[model samples]
Target: MTTPAQRQTALLVSVVGAVIVALDGTILLMAQPVMQRDLGASVAHIQWTSTGYLVAVAALLVIAGRLGDQYGHARLLFVGVLGFGAASAGIALAPSVGWVIVLRVVQGGFAAFLQPATLALLRLAYPADRLGKPIAIRTGAIAVAAGSGPLLGGVLVAHLGWRAVFWVNVPLAFVIAVLALTVRTPATQRGNSPRLNVTSAGLLAIALATLVHALADVPARGWTAAPTLLEFLAVIGVATMLTRHERRTTHPVVPPAVARSVPVTASMALLLVTTAGLFGALFRATFHLQDVLRLDPLDSGLRVLPLTVLMVLGSPAAVAAMRRYGARRTAIAGTVLVVVGIAGLSRLGPASTWMAMAAAFAAIGAGFATVMVTATGTVVGDAPPGYAGVVSGLKQTAMNIGPTFGIAVAAGATGTAASTMGSTLLILAALAALGLLPASRLPRRPARQEGEHDTTAALPAQAPTPQAAPARHTNS
Candidate 1:
């Protein structure tokens, strides 16, 4: 029952939210060197600015998604956008490195709320058959934000001052907030009214924090450090306890049955691998471009333009590919492209040409666009209606974790930055190759026909009852 104008506004809001999230990831890269010099920080301390953001985003995403479900998505979206903007402003005005880090954590927390709500809003706003176009548009926006952030950040940091990089979000957020007010809330209702499980949330946060600490310390202390080992063990133990507690709770954070589903598990795995490669490449590429290639921040950002452009260009084709070949084939094809792209990048040396790197980025960007679109569709399509928030949260979590793990591994690789990048790219390529294994197992067509009676009557009353037969393959 949504009006066309309403849908348009909703799409705009979601796109803006997504762009902000993407910018959050890449914008800081350009500002890092400047901030370090101004704040008189060590390399490790500067790196934590990005790490802290990732950790905060990862830890809070699920809880935020649930809050959107319990409260209202539109409301949460507004709050998140405003909070994010404020935090950005704080970062812009901060005098001390510690203040900047604290503000980044705030920005990440707000981002957590914004991201999942955007996805939930999209899922609610569009019908199933027509979802492709909007999702494609959303993917395109994310690519643009991510691809442009470095360049934009570089320019801002060099010419305007590093603070300008953050100030930019304030105006953008205002525009998005105004547009957001015009959108209609979806008709979906939460009947059970699940409350936030404080204990579970706390435990999960601690687990992630511990993991990040362990990862950060591993290189310096090695695996034998008593504290690192203890933190690792604590993370496992806390996570195990959280899982058990959630499973027994009447209203679990992530429902046990849904988490165990093949589609959900597979989709999460795809997200983890794809994001790890994409973010890892971004991190390393930025460093290599600036530190090794002697490129200015602006130049470094510009170097990644090919990747961004290709992602935008490749989105529609990816959607079409999904429709024609089914999710499995489309995903596998994308993964192959990612593998090729990473392998190509693995060939980079100290003397590699800019054109060579651009080509590598372009390949990776295309692959990333394809896989991201496909993986998102597959995960959301397979989720039960009531659990969309949780599914989206899980996707966000995987996305965050992927980058964190990738950076940890890549940073730890032996040799110079160029050599380490080569090795990391190869590892990423292997991960991309592994994606084919799961892609092969996805059902090639819809699991249900256009119209069929429900067979599983014992499912929860609130769950959407399936009323269709498995869609038959036309060829078969």
Candidate 2:
């Protein structure tokens, strides 16, 4: 067993990596105009600095996660962190917006690699019973970073310029990469051997890229646009083939071995639904606060700072709820809070009342905290002994996809920013309501003992953990 000190180090390294990626994901928004000015790029070109990154990460996250499972999480984490650091520096020094956009895509790919490793490492290092707190803390950290990223980026841009934003990630990634080399976690032990079906992986990559691109176009091009329709058609066609291939293959991207675990599936669904609403609400809140209220980015970020703070502060309570009342009840309560939060946001009007906005943001953050903590812990805990990476990948993919869909839906709603935002929040409230049933379905507690390692929790209790499940090779 690893010492507690080592586990702490592992958590620290993981948290560091998570923070940089989460921050970079949205932080650049505050600095994009400055970047455009510096590069003499058009609004559309500068915009891809963010859009391309999102699409790339969404496309590559599952593949990266599978690779981590096949090789080693720690090995991948080290490479990912180092690569991200290099890409960040490259972006900072780029002379043109196009170069920066290209580098940002590379940065997102590195983020996909590092993200799954962090979760897999935490799952491996900690005991099952004790997983909630660490996961809660991890979730809280990432949430706060993501929620308040613009605020931080605004400060960096004002003081040091846009390049400072990317430059900040370089040091953190280097530190984490060094830690990956020095620290020995269970992730380095070489366990599950995930097989990659080239055909399926390629199909999934293309499908997701096309789907997200189409979703991204919804706001600008409308749902009826030819490009959007064509993109959806491509997604559907590719997905059908991929599904057929996965069903027939032994070592598909999802790994037929652990694909059917109800608990795992439910957790992923919970993540996707909750994040969709929560992220949508966040967008609406930002637009309402900044666009309607006429607050500057910094001011808007500051106004919502309490909401970000509450996300971090609320975790201990969530951890307590999980321990005392069980994950099922706690998660149910949390899902209800998401509905409450979105419902509160739906009440937002042309005037951004202080009390109404404050309360809504708080509810969203607190509620999302519980759901994120619970879903992450459950997805990891319920995986079959050899498929942590697979489930982890699936979980992260839901997360990435959630915000994409949320932002798209909210953006596509009719009228001005505030009006459409209000519309989307109402829709999100409905989505949150639909999530209630699944939230209530999670296991009361993890099925495995704290010290028992592996994805064995999803397997029959009496079954031995598949310590070395190898990649499959089809018969000729």
Candidate achieving the largest lDDT? 2
For residues 1-476, could you state the per-residue lDDT of candidate 1 as single tens digits?
Answer: 46777778878898888998798677877888888998898888886787677778877888888777777778888899999999999999999999988888889889988888887776666544455667789899998888777777877887998888899999988888887777785555564556778888788778876786676665456566798789889999999999888878776777654566666677678878777777666666667777877887667667788888989988888888776777777778888888888788888876888788889988888888888887777666555545566677888887877776666555555423565777777876786677777666554753232233334423333332233221122100
Least lDDT summed over 10 consecutive residues: which range in candidate 2? Answer: 467-476
lDDT of 2 by residue, 181-203 (tens): 86665543344353578888999
TM-score of 1: 0.89
Q: How far is candidate 1 from the true structure (C-alpha RMSD, Å)?
A: 3.8
